[model samples]
Target chain A: MPQVNMTVNGKPASGDVEGRTLLVEFLRETLDLTGTHVGCDTSQCGACVVHVDGKAVKACTMFAAEADGAEVLTIEGVAAPDGTLDPVQEAFHQHHGLQCGFCTPGMVMSAKALLAENPTPTEAEVRDYLEGNICRCTGYHNIVKAIMAASGQDVSKIAAE
Target chain B: MYAFDIERPTTLADAVKLLAASDENQALGGGQTLIPTLKQRLAMPEVLVSLTAIDEIKGISEDDEGRLCIGAATTHAEVAAGAGKYPALAALAGNIGDPAVRNRGTIGGSLANNDPSACYPAAALGSGAIIVTNTREIAADDYFEGMFATVLDEGEIITEVKFPVPEKAAYMKFEQPASRFALVGAFVAKYADGVRVAVTGASEEGVFRWSEAEAALGSNFSPDAIERLSLSGDGMISDLHGSGEYRAHLVGVMTKRAVAAAG
Candidate 1:
């Protein structure tokens, strides 16, 4: 087992993980943070997307050990301290970005990461950026709208207050 | 995935040594492809040498001669963003699968794996780039031999890839809707010496230069010149996403677009 020490969801965390343990597996199985779903073992599906060092990555495509000493933010981390939804999350709810909610966690996380980097993204840019996160339910029309709406909002000010 | 040992080395030399020490060891870069393969049990390496910690293999730099030296471990996002210094290369990088894939996938891993549908091969092959490993520098022409094949010796870690600033270049791809990997992609470069056209995602033997198009475009670098050339389905790869003939058609179409974009 490889020893891994890193900050997960703004908290210091450590564990001895098997070499074959993927970051998604580690988060879901070990940490019990099951919000990050595993829709496809292949990297094509962004259902296991998460933020590693503030950059969105496919958690299924990364080993738990690879995230050592790195900051990891999951769907859980995006919520407010009082458990309220983040702006991106609220935007998704308001815009009806999800239907069955199977792909909601990954979609919300990907959008959060996107807005964190680019607060204001064009429609084409949003579509291009979210290409990795697949949504079989929504057909992506409303999800794109939610992202654009969230991008225009002042997330920092909302988070601060 | 089966159980194995993972080693994260801090230096390139150490990573190479680790890979060299074991025949069953595999070097891990980005893990965008390797991890999924492992999860499917297609690859069962006894040991994995992680390259992320090696600082020497992770940035972009330009020399006095305008040649760009990109660290092998530099992620696609970095490449896409940094390739602005080299517009064609950046544009090519930007067109890779998506932002998430770009954020994690690295040029070194992509080149080392040499997937037939991968975008980087067309760029590396079209640019006539130089791949510098820890041991020696290998010309791009000599580097890729076949599908998922390269001349890289075991334990030889790629440090960086050096790309010449082309006089003009562009890349175009018809991506597979499901996987986002290219169904057919073409990269064209017009250097001071001559024009080179490399086609990927269309051949059974992996990325290969389209000699017919290259010959016609060498004299007249134009889309009209390439439109006259013929690309057939003979010996092409056929898969679930696209048939060999369909891929061949895309190759020509993408080549025309790429050549036009290069101008």
Candidate 2:
């Protein structure tokens, strides 16, 4: 077993993991942070998307050992400590961005990462960026709208509210 | 996935020593391909030696001669972002699968695996790149043998790939709707000596050069030259995505587009 020491959701965390353990497995199985789902074992699906070192990555495609020293942020980390939804999360809820919600965590994660990088992304760029995250439900039309709406709102304002 | 020992070697020599210890060991670069294969039980290696920690195996630098040296562990995102000096190569990298795949996939892993639908082999072959392995530097023509096959030995690991700066080059791929892997991809390079055209995702034997298109375009690098050439479907791959004949037709279409784009 590999001993991994890393910061999770802004807190120092440590765990012993098997060689075959993936980051998604560590987050879901060991840490019990089951919000990150594994839809496809292949890298094609972004259902396991999470921020490692502030960059979005499909956790399923990465070995837990690979993220040993990295800082990881999951969907659960995006909300307030008081459990209120973040701006992007609220936007998704307000705009009905989710249907089945199987892919919601990943979709929200990808959008958060995208907005973090580019506050105002064009619709085509949003479509291209979210292409990796597959949504069998909602067809992504409202999700794009939610992301645009989220991008316009101030994070500080959302936090104050 | 099967249980296996994983080793993260910090140095090239250490990696070599780890790989030499057992023939059942596999070198892990970015794990975009290897992880999926392992999860699906398609490949079972007793040990996985990760090359990520080795600082020597990452980065893109240029030699005094202007040859672009890309470390084997350099991610597609790095290449796409022009972490190396080549903008065209970066553009090609950006067009690969998607941003997530680009972030985790490495050029060395892609070239080493040599998936028939992969986008790197076409660029490697088209640009006359050199595959620098632990043992020797193999030319692009001699490196790739067949599907998922290369001249690399069991313990051998690709250290870097050196691509000669071309006069002009471009790559065009008809992506598979579902997987986003190339259904038919063509890379065209017009160098001082002649033009080299390579086609991937169409050949059953992996990436192959289009001699007819090359010969025709050697005189004049243009889409018109590609229109005159006929790509045979004799040894092309036929799958649910596309038939051999359809792939052959796409080879021609993509070649014209790539040639036009290269201009």
Candidate 3:
């Protein structure tokens, strides 16, 4: 086992983990931050998306040892300390962005990264950026709408609740 | 994934020395493809030498000859943002897997693994890029051997890749919906002297140069130039996604599309 240290959601965290331990496993099992879901263990399903050094990456695809001494942001750290929801979460709530909610954490993380890069992305851009985050229940209609709304764009043109 | 010892060396020399130290050591670049392979028990390496931390192999720049020089550890996202000099190559990097994948997956990793349907192979072969390793430089033609295979010896690390900018170029891929990998893809690059057409994803022999199409387009430089040209299905990959004949047909279609786009 290797001792790895990283900043998780603004907190310095350290743990002893196997070389093959995935970053997702370290976050969920070791650090007890289960907000980052793993919908598919494979890299295709972006359900394990997290921000490592300001860039969104699949947590399940990277090893914990590889992320040592890095800054990592998970779904648990998205909102304010006062428990107020972030704009993306608020929009998701308002727009019904999730149904079963298995994929909301990843969808939100991916959307946050997208909005950070392109503050005013078009509808097509939003759809394109979320290609990795798959929402099987919502059909992605409301997820797109929520992301657009989070970017302070007009989401009325998007259909559905 | 099976248990293994991991080493993250900040210097390229140290990384190379560690890889050379043990026969079971495997180099890890981004680990986008290799990690998945390891999870399936496909490979068992005793020491995993990670190369992402090496500063020497992590940037995009252009040399005096105007060729694009990309470090091996440079991520796809970095290439997508920095490789503006080569728009076709940048576009291919941008559409590799997805946003997250683009953020983590590196060009060196993609080229080293040499997945048959990988987009970089087409770009490298089409542009006549040179792969610079720790030991020496290898032409794209000599680098790729076959599916999941390359000419790189153990402990030989790809430090950088130099790509010759073409006058006009484009890559067109018919993606397999599930994996987003090219079912059949073609990269068309037109230079001053000649044209190169590299095809991937459709061949059992891995990425290959479509010389007939290249010869036809070299003179005329248009989709109609290779309209009558066709490929044999003898060495084509046939899976549930497509048949050998279907993929063979797609090669022509993608090549035409690539030429039209480049033109």
DockQ of each: 0.75, 0.67, 0.90
Which residue pairs overlap in candidate 1's backbone? none
Which candidate number would show the highest lDDT if scored against the true structure? 3
TM-score of chain A of 2: 0.92
Each model's number of backbone clashes?
0, 0, 0
In the range A75-132, model 2's lDDT, one tens digit per residue, is 9899999999999999999878899998999999999988887889877788889989
Off by over 4 Å in 1: A153-161
Candidate 2 RMSD to the correct structure: 3.4
lDDT of 1 by residue, A1-161 (tens): 66899898999888889988889888998888999999886877788999999999989889998998999999989988999989889888887889998888888988887787788987777888888888898888888888887877433322111
Which prediction has the highest DockQ against the true structure?
Answer: 3
Task: Identify the runs in model 3 with alpha carbons over 4 angstroms from their true place.
Answer: none
Better of 2 and 3 by lDDT: 3
Per-residue error for A128 in candidate 2, Å, reads 0.6
Q: Return the lDDT, model 1, position B154.
A: 82
**lDDT for every model?**
0.88, 0.88, 0.94
| TM-score (chain A only) for the predictions, listed in order | 0.91, 0.92, 0.98
